[model samples]
Target chain A: MAANNEFVGGKVMTTLYQHGTLALLVPGLFTGTQTVGELLKHGDTGIGTLEGLDGELIIMDGIVYQVNAMGQVRVVNADETVPFANVHKAHPQPKIAVEDASSDALKQIALKELKTENLFAAIRVDGEFSQMHTRAVLPQTKPYPTLAATAEGQHEFNATNIKGTIIGYFSPVIYAGAVAAGFHLHFLSEDHVMGGHILDFDLAKGNLQIETFDNFNLHLPVHDPDFLETKINAKQAMRDIAKAEN
Target chain B: MAANNEFVGGKVMTTLYQHGTLALLVPGLFTGTQTVGELLKHGDTGIGTLEGLDGELIIMDGIVYQVNAMGQVRVVNADETVPFANVHKAHPQPKIAVEDASSDALKQIALKELKTENLFAAIRVDGEFSQMHTRAVLPQTKPYPTLAATAEGQHEFNATNIKGTIIGYFSPVIYAGAVAAGFHLHFLSEDHVMGGHILDFDLAKGNLQIETFDNFNLHLPVHDPDFLETKINAKQAMRDIAKAEN
Candidate 1:
């Protein structure tokens, strides 16, 4: 019974998408377009990828899955193409609790329930998982090397008591190397057949949802003639996207 | 004709807005409402204020000035009321000149043309200011005395050889105790009669414009039943809003 005037004059319409920048996908510049049916006609949830880089994406509630490349997950056709994403549209709040921590101690208890670390949070933890280590990447074409050489070789998965729901984001270490500098999660399994992204887990309890993003809008592809004629070499592409998107 | 397919699929539908959180406007929750004529519907530009903490706002291009507290500057009034702000919406890019610089060297040359700093940018420059330093507060009620003690009195103003267009925002330092962590400007000269907020300026050349937001939406007033039952005491309200909203 408390959402505080649900954002009176402080405004809060929530809409996020960074698209391309890790200094332009580590200089590889992988193309993009097939926008996920216009981000599911106004988001319902998020996580991203697809479009040639074929694989790993999760959009819960509004349906839109795709894990591909051997590790197989599925759901996405009608020609889904979105290259990178980070959707949002669930403004519900109030749902806390859980047990075992881990995953950097749930990012220091969601950084003390996000007092500050430079805002941007959308963590959802739904339950059941004594173990979980996911990964999913495999799809790149036309000379694309960075993204730590296309995430070197990802295809790891482990699940124990699984039900699932991680879908996350914290983003702030000045966007470390461009994204995932602070936190980034992605997982799905409510029988939608396993998931990807997330790299660690434990969560003893379940049902945790946190949302905090305070106004930010950045959309740039500059009509892409190589997105401003690529040249990005920012310190070895922020050290290969801080060791492959952290 | 190179908008680079405007983010083809990399997706970039930015929209940032973190309305309330300096631990709930430092215990003094100065009531809010008029929502800046509804954030000028799709934003024309920004910088915030108005509710109780009367004066000093700047909406530029989409119109909405203020600056009260003695310094008097007018314009806003479509039922204005906003409490805090940070608008955007103008993806036209390509305008650079800026000279003499200062203001953290134009934020380190706009952080190297903003490659990344955890996204959120709208900096416009325009130009022709030989000098400028502004402020403008003076409007609070309900025993409110935080905000670095009502910004310990503010009303400074200075201008000379001016034309105008400062409306700024950079935000990222975990929203410096909830907003205005990194950069936050607000000047409007050009015939709209001097403005406020910006605390310094010297631009030499003109035309600077830069936009980037990548999504972020945080609007929480929760129907202000004391806004989620106020309780924020986070290190003296984040050292009094990181020393008065950065």
Candidate 2:
């Protein structure tokens, strides 16, 4: 779904929310044909943004929903366009678990599994989270500010007793702009009532599912006239992604 | 200008080929509006394939050309579509020059200047070469085979007394599917008589111009039905790219 989403080429598959390379949804450039229904055909799980970055998109178990600007999560229109997303079929590993672990500590365990930075991986954290902090960017209009600027206006949320799965991608630093250099994740409650890119969390009891992808395939938005004409500055974008995603 | 050719924030800049994520040219996908002229707007140098995999696309000093399957070089039509290309503005580093240098030795020098592999870089080696070997992929059509399969039919060339620039990119391992994990170079003779994706070469003497990209931006071809439907196997594609480009 994003950079390092591949392992030289392997059997595991993973998708991501818009990688930094394809991040920053261009305003007025929506109306895409890649819908949730279409995306589901490719993978059963992933994250992305609705057309115009209208809200956060969370695709889990083939169903799609949007976390609107009001922090309300609801099933989305199947025909709605998805300008950017990262997803993959779910493949949970039952061997890893933690009853009480901070997000930072859990990430260390995941890193141990990584072994090397070159591989692309998908992570799933399921169970109850005693505490979690998340954020989502409100959609923008034409002349959209850089993703970093939009991130500055992110809506923050704090939740407790949240039962859901945290989904994300682990990219290498080399892919900084192509995708997030490191982990880029989003959240979805079991009830589909809460979701957005995750910032921090504490799991009272959670199990981790890790799937590694050896190879990656990325399809870009070429037909969009604005995408064709834009003069992109990647350095700043990487900075913005880091500031916002982390 | 592909995915990394971003207008998103008009700020994020990145350089990746249609290298190895959204690298390959899919079948039944053509009539791209992102022309050689359009690519030139972003940078003056790069390497890619023309629409329908017509030929090798080499853009040097702002002019784009195709090295056909027959090994004949000619200026490409500005309107010609480029399905996949890797390009960036020229950055001539006079201090990085070597006389009577083999391509292998020269690469070491460039690596030293790199200092870090985290950034995307465009490398230009301009000078005389005692011997050079290059190859190009013929344009393709609908029901296109995987790039690895297409590589089996690649056309190769060997040359001496060649002078001009070798244009290409250096991506990190994590971006293997998105860009070449290492050096991916293309040759364009100063006389505009020959060029192709690099295979091997002996540079009698050459000057190295390495431009570091702080960020990367890319656009995926989403409208292509195949892009949306195909189950990408990045592992095999990377292998194929290695077989063809290296």
Chain A (candidate 1) TM-score to true chain A: 0.34
Candidate 2 chain B: worst 10 consecutive residues by lDDT?
B19-28
User: DockQ for each of the predicted structures, in order?
Assistant: 0.06, 0.05
Query: Which CAPRI tier for candidate 1?
Result: incorrect
Clash number for model 2?
40
The C-alpha interface RMSD of every prediction is: 12.2, 14.2
Candidate 1 lDDT over B1-246, as tens digits, reads: 111112524664555554555555666676773377666764677777877778778876678888787887888876767756766666678987878887678878887897656456778888887888888878888777667777778778888778888878886543344565678788878887778888777786687877876544444444456654555554577677767655
Q: How accurate is candidate 2 locally (lDDT)?
A: 0.66
Global CA lDDT computed for model 1: 0.68
* Candidate 2 residue lDDT tens string, B1-246: 123334333544344434224334322333352567666665777887786667677777788878887788998777777666766666555557678777777778877787655456788887999988888877667666666666677899988988978888776554565666788888878887788878888888877888766435453443444443444444555566566556
